[model samples]
Target: MRIAFASGKGGTGKTTVAVNLAVSAVRVGLGTAYVDCDVEEPNGHIYLEPEKDLSLPVAVEVPEIDESLCTVCGECGRICEFNAIAVLGDRVMVFPELCHGCGGCFLVCPVDAMKRSGRLVGRVETGVSKIAPCGEDRTAPGGEGEISFVQGILKVKEAMPLPVIREVKKHIPDRDIVIIDCPPGNSCPMVESVRGADRVILVTEPTPFGLNDLEIALKTVREMDIPVDIIMNRCDPDAELPAGAFDDGGARVIARIPESREIAEINSRGGLASLESPEFARIIDKILEKILRAAREARR
Candidate 1:
């Protein structure tokens, strides 16, 4: 099943949930792949360390203007909704960044002065992790097996993230459980990453800002008609948002990871909390159980 771990804002622990879920899934002998859809800041590889096996460049089409096509009537410029085409007296210029590949400028050009051209957006890298010893399957909750990991990384400074995210998702295995580490914020990139997945796990904290963004993300996912569950990371009893809020809103509360100094230390050291804390690992296993159960029900 394809599951996407996303959040409305940054530092809400989406990647933390995604990586731990992937590691847990792998522990059960489930051939799994983790796609880091956060192309702008892909840190999923930092934990999994998948070997770079394949790299593919992703490109997007933009408008290119032909200067020799006679008069700059401004027709093409006016027709472009993205403001990609501009008329400068007798010359017409096309801004590649502004172009959305809608081809409106090309269609409106009387002399066919506008043409489609490609620009490199980003690249996708595929890598597999070396098999690690089975140290009592911490992800399955009373289960045991060896774990294998795989990850995808997008090239840095890539503005268009959807293309790279789509390419990374293409590597998901049929029988394996797939977890996508989606980019933060409820934008096009986040939408593309979670689209058509079996389920989505929204990770957030217990603060007002977290609740506000969580509401935005909930709306986005509801509009997409996808099922979502909540995981309150760094949960505190005295927090502003209650744990039952998600359940009351018609979504399940899969897990609640309490705030801990040990977790902070492990996070500072760039390590997975589940790897450092066995208690947190159990919580991840419970989350995985919910995911697995949901996947099974969908298939039936």
Candidate 2:
């Protein structure tokens, strides 16, 4: 089963839920593989320090001008949909960052001077986490004992995330449950990560901002025709739309993690919050059960 955890906005604890859920799934011997689709800022590896067995360089095709071809009719620049190419007098400059690799510029180049060049976009690292030498469980929250797998990381300042996200998702095992830690946003990256997912767990807090973004994310998921479940992280009884509200909406309230200093302390220490907090772990387990139930029903 491929499940993706995403939020409409950042800092809403999507990663926290995703990482924990993967660990929980692995704990039950599901052979879960967690893919950090948040390529822009992949923090999942920080929690589960998997060894780097294979590192494949990811590149994107960008327009490269061959100045020797001469005729700078400026047609390439004019035809570029992304404005990635610019022609100044007799000089043609290619701004790779602006290029979307559509190949339109090269196709439109009258002189056939524009060609495709590979520019480094990011890389995918595959490996498994070796049990710590001390015999302690090193896997993050959801990883109860120890598990190993592959992880992808997008180079900083890389604007394109969908390609890398797709590449990483391709590595997911057929029988293994895959949990994608999506980038925090309702943009292309998040969309790509959530696409074709069996279920999406939208994690959020109880604040007004969290509620607002959650609604937006819910709308997005509905539009995509993807089943969604809500998990209210840091839920406070005093906050609006208490636990029952989420359940009332058709989407189950699988987990309600109360706000606590322990969460902060563990996060500060770069440790999995669910691993240190039994309450948090239980909440994650409930979400996992709901996910499995939904999966089984769909199969039937």
Candidate 3:
């Protein structure tokens, strides 16, 4: 089963929930893998601390124009919606950063001057990590077991992240459970990360800003027909949420992590909250149970 943890915006405890759930899954003796799809800012490795085992470069196809054989007919420029290829005077300029590799330029080239080429955008790193139960030492041998780790690092100034996200997902090990930590927001990168998830957990806070973006995320996931639930991070019981917060197409609030300074401090120190806080551990277990139940229901 593949479970994706995402947020409407950054700093919503999305990665916190994802990594802890993966570790909890491993602690329960399930074959598990943690895939960090936030290529532009992947930080799950900081918590997992997996020993690096492999690194592979990820590249994307871009148009390479051969000016020598070219007739500046402007066909390639006209066909390109992203303006990746343009004819300026007698020369053809190709901006690989803007290219989506849709083959529009190649198909519309009347002189066959456009050729396919690769642009290195990022890399995928795979590693192995071990996790123990909530109370046990992670480095101990008795109950600890290995979990596969995969993350993508996008090169600076890269305009696109879907290519690197796809590359990272391709390395998801066969496991009883896989948790994907997706980039924040409801953009193309977020959509691609949650594409085939059995269940998606949208983490948000009970605030005006958080709920506003959460609505957008809910719509995106519903449009894709994926089963989704909401997790309220730093939830305050006294704060009254807006009326109709759960009305219409909104997802149910399946779990809530209360506001805790300890959790914040632990996370700031690159420690898993579930391993340090008993209350946080219980919340993770409850969330994991709900996720497992949802996955089973989906398969049925």
TM-score leader = 3
TM-score of 3: 0.92
- As a whole number from 0 to 100, the lDDT of residue 117 in candidate 3 is 95
Candidate 3 C-alpha lDDT tens digits along 146-177: 77899999999997999999988889998888
Clashes of 1: 1
Query: Model 3 Cα displacement at 27 (Å)?
Result: 0.8
For model 3, the superposed segments whose C-alpha errors exceed 4 Å read 131-144, 237-241
Candidate 1 residue runs with Cα over 4 Å from true position? 70-73, 131-158, 237-248
- Across 21-110, the per-residue lDDT of candidate 1 in tens digits comes to 776676766766777888888887777766677777777677777778738889977888877777898798888876656667777879
Decide which is better by lDDT, 2 or 3: 3
Quote the lDDT for 288 in model 3.
87
Top candidate by lDDT: 3
Q: For model 1, where is the 10-residue window of minimal lDDT? A: 141-150
Query: Which pairs of residues collide in model 3?
Result: none
**lDDT against the true structure, each candidate:** 0.75, 0.76, 0.86
Per-residue lDDT of candidate 2, residues 1-300 (tens digit)? 888898787887887787777767776666677778888888877777777678888878888888899488888888887878778987989899987777787777778887779988888877765332212443344433444565667788888877678888777666458887888888788888899899998888878788778877888888899889877778774444545335446566566778888887887667776667887778787888889999999899
Model 2 — which ten-residue stretch has the worst lDDT?
130-139
- Candidate 1 vs 2: which has more lDDT: 2
